[model samples]
Target: MLDLTKLAREMQGISQHLSQEAVASRQRLELAQQHLKKAYECQQEVMERQEKWRDRILFANATPLEPLNTRIDIPVPPKVHTVIATDGSQIAPNHHEIAYCYLLNIGRVVLHYGQNRYPLMDSLPEVFYRPEDLYMSRQWGIKTEEWMSYRRTASEATVLAELVREVGTGDGGLGTGRRKTGDLGSREENNNQSLIPHPQSPIPALAMVDGSLIYWFLEQLPVDARDRILPPILEAWSQMRAAQIPLMGYLSASRNVEGVNFLRLLACPHPAPDCVSYCPNQLEKVPCKVFEPLRDTALWTTQLTPGQRGPLWRSNNRILELYADQTIYFCHVHVGTEIARIEVPAWVAENTAMFDQALGLMLAQVQKGCGYPVAIAEAHNQAVVRGGDRTRFFCVVRETND
Candidate 1:
């Protein structure tokens, strides 16, 4: 074993240095606290005054904002419901290895909640050896890891869509509602009112993904390559929407500050007829500049209670812009004192019943796993490639090839 004396001394010195830096940082924050408070006040004031001219901000297409102070307590899920989640892991290509290739694995878990929680697990691992997979294409100019990541996300979506379709259209799925001794329209009205299923009614199911529906990295590719890569994702999304399966992207310990950016937009002190072009330098000014460093989770931490979720805020990114009509919305949620960021598409957000049901199931999943979603946790567990497994995998491949 190595001697600890020298290592201990070095660690002590580093710890002391970190402590001094922390003290200095706290002092700096204290100095800026007043400016941040003033910036927040300005943001609230501007939002109040621009109620009628709200479209001005939307037209600018910078950061979008909903009401920031609203919070809703998600309801508990039904006794008998199903949640399906998918996650992916990758082993990137290593130049030192004999083969110039990459590996991707998608793991899926379906949990049925009833008298007892039953889980179904599945995984698909793919190896890429094509010329396009091993080298950067002249057309796209993207590395293998980047393109493979998008492909994996598309694969996850495809799997989720297929699962949802199977459940929704299968026997005793959502399509088969309980027809009581009444007219068809009356039965439809009754089915709409009830959150739980009737004896013969189709069971409700939700399909979840570990990340956002819109793959933002697709922006890195050229138009032609982007078109080629986008059809699978779009088709999967379309299928999910048509199937009425609420798809959620859950991010634990998310550090996104999109909400803070929106507040900064509102706090801009410039008096321009058009905020985007004319007020370019407004953010560098006093109040807006103060909030530039704060994120939504940090700013709203004190406002949210356990199990509470905030109002939806629209995304202003280019990918969301590409699908402006079918935009994505997100909100912060407090799960057992740990905050998480959740994203859903416009189709789920617009339907109140569906949104409530989806959020309820998510909350239940988190409760079951303390602070994280159980379905996602199991999927990750199945997808992860441990160090020993990775070594053995390469060794086996080499042996087979030799």
Candidate 2:
């Protein structure tokens, strides 16, 4: 009986050891699988990099040839004007918070009511465009903030519709329509009819948003939303034409998927000259005339030596520093005979590359004089709020005299 007991104890010990060994083997297999996954991921990254290089080469070789320019000078009409409006907003990540700032330009017409002054035509024609309506939240994170902020602040389609309705019916306190009477009418009736005048020629107004948010908003819109917005845009176009308005444009500026800033120029077909073009470089020369005087007096005063300023001026390094430091700098640039000194934040300098690309693209397009109305918008990360958390997308409209 003692020997049998000894044998049973030995078998039990051996079984326990084998169980532990099996668990260890399973762990080893799992570790091997993880290593293989890492290797596969690395290989994928390499393949992607090689494919991108090949694509770049193909694109570089396929540059499109420029079109021939036909020289023509047409007489411009008197009282022909263009209206431009710009607005910006911020979107935060995973929240419902948003902020907005907007500016409207009604060509030469300026109207004042109480303490507020508005352009003759408001960009957000509907009451929905009120600044107080702007808010911030973070439910959707960064992506949601961007989309919602843009949806509310960057779309001019609603505003344009309101303008058309106002002009067409003369209903928004403008008192436009007049009554007419036949000769058979009595003297009092004739007098009343004479007091009414013909409808004035509608002023061409171009509502401009700062980015491609307008397009994006339109694209993501549901079928019902599209049905609601499209009619108003078209109606506005028709009213302007009926009133003999030459042309109207909507400009959007945005960044490409690569984060490069660009302007989306669009317009209704009209007799006005319009075109789209781009410059390879626009911010090459610093607006030194605007900055030199201020730099000497305020930025690089006697406290800072010329040697220090020298490094700052080298290839926008100083500008970048100022922006990173968030300091205010004065720029001096020549506008006509007088030197214009402009105060700008250092952040503008840090973002010079993006601004340059956007400005260059717009200037090139405006220079073309193609006779079609155009709108331009810009998209990129801009430091809008005081704190770093307020960073958001901005859009602007570009207006050209030509």
Candidate 3:
């Protein structure tokens, strides 16, 4: 454990530094707020010149698709809409272990709020030990921990896509009439009740995941591994899009400064942005220093009302250039508890109706869970592999091997 007694002096020093920074932070925020006001006054010009900045900044920042200050009210969610979500957890492989194995546990959830559908909740735990799984991992020259996370991402997407296809094909098993118990605790069959989709009238649903859709980590691997791993995930996404499902990734209490960074670009005093010359780190000492202490969510909270959502912006990243149709777009919305960041693919962002409804449904979900999305929270509950479970898993493997 940690010796708090020994850390007292260090803690005091840290506190003193924070107190000094607090004064500096306020000055940065004030200058940023001023620049934001100027941008709002000339919003049209700002939008027009957005394309030019991409060439100058040469870094990832959110480019507003519409007016910077525009806010859309959350449309009231439909009385009968379904929210389907999937989340994942993993047991990373340790080299010291006899079995150098990793496990991925995916939680699948279907919460039907309409007339005839019952919710379905289940977890899928997949353990990899096959030569192909290990062989491809070793080829990347990365740690098993890093490699396992990539696998988990692919697995989670595949699982969500599979469920979306199931719902699309009318095999979701959500049926009419309530089952004797609430939701299925495990994968047991509810033979007593009639299934959810009648195959005639399918329910409208929204698909969600608990984290980012961007597979940035996959870029670190070799071309062979990237080709091997990313295609299946892209294909899974393709399936969801082909089925016309509205999929999203929900990030709560996000401190992402992509929006603020865009402000930095706007606030840059350069006729031509020569970052290496004038400003490098965007520090208080630099030319583009106004937004240094600000965050996207914090800035948005000051602007967005309880029911309003900020504009969707196409996020810039080199990895996204290859995504083609899967390029990411994100928005900040006041979800009562905090200003939450919501990310979606290019198609959803392009479709006006889908975008509004997506926000509304997410807001409804947040209200249900008080501060977070209920489907994601429940999915996390199902997916999490606690310390006890991890210990027992090794014990079981040891016994089986003996």
Candidate with best TM-score: 3
lDDT digits (tens) for residues 127-162 of candidate 1: 776675566444466767777776677666665665
- Scored by lDDT, the top model is 3
Instruction: Indicate the worst ten consecutive residues by lDDT in candidate 1.
Output: 181-190
Query: How high is the CA lDDT of each candidate model?
Result: 0.66, 0.28, 0.76
Candidate 2 per-residue lDDT, tens place, 1-402, comes to: 469988999999999999997776556444433432343345344333323433221111110011101111112222333333333333332223232333221111111112122324212111122322323213223243343444433233333333334434433212212212111111111111111232465433333333221133444545444444344434433443453322222222211111000000101122211221122233443211112112122221222231111111111112222223333322222221222222222333335442233222222224322311133321111212333333322221111111
Comparing 1 and 2 on TM-score, the stronger one: 1
Count of clashing residue pairs in every prediction: 0, 46, 3
Candidate 3 residue-wise lDDT, 76-118, digit = tens:
9887777888898988776766687778898888887865766
User: Per-prediction TM-score, please?
Assistant: 0.76, 0.28, 0.87
* Cand. 2 Cα-lDDT: 0.28
Residue 135 lDDT (model 3) = 61
After superposing candidate 1 on the true structure, give the runs of residues whose Cα lies further than 4 Å from its correct spot: 1-66, 94-99, 115-118, 136-138, 170-200, 273-287, 399-402
lDDT of 1: 0.66
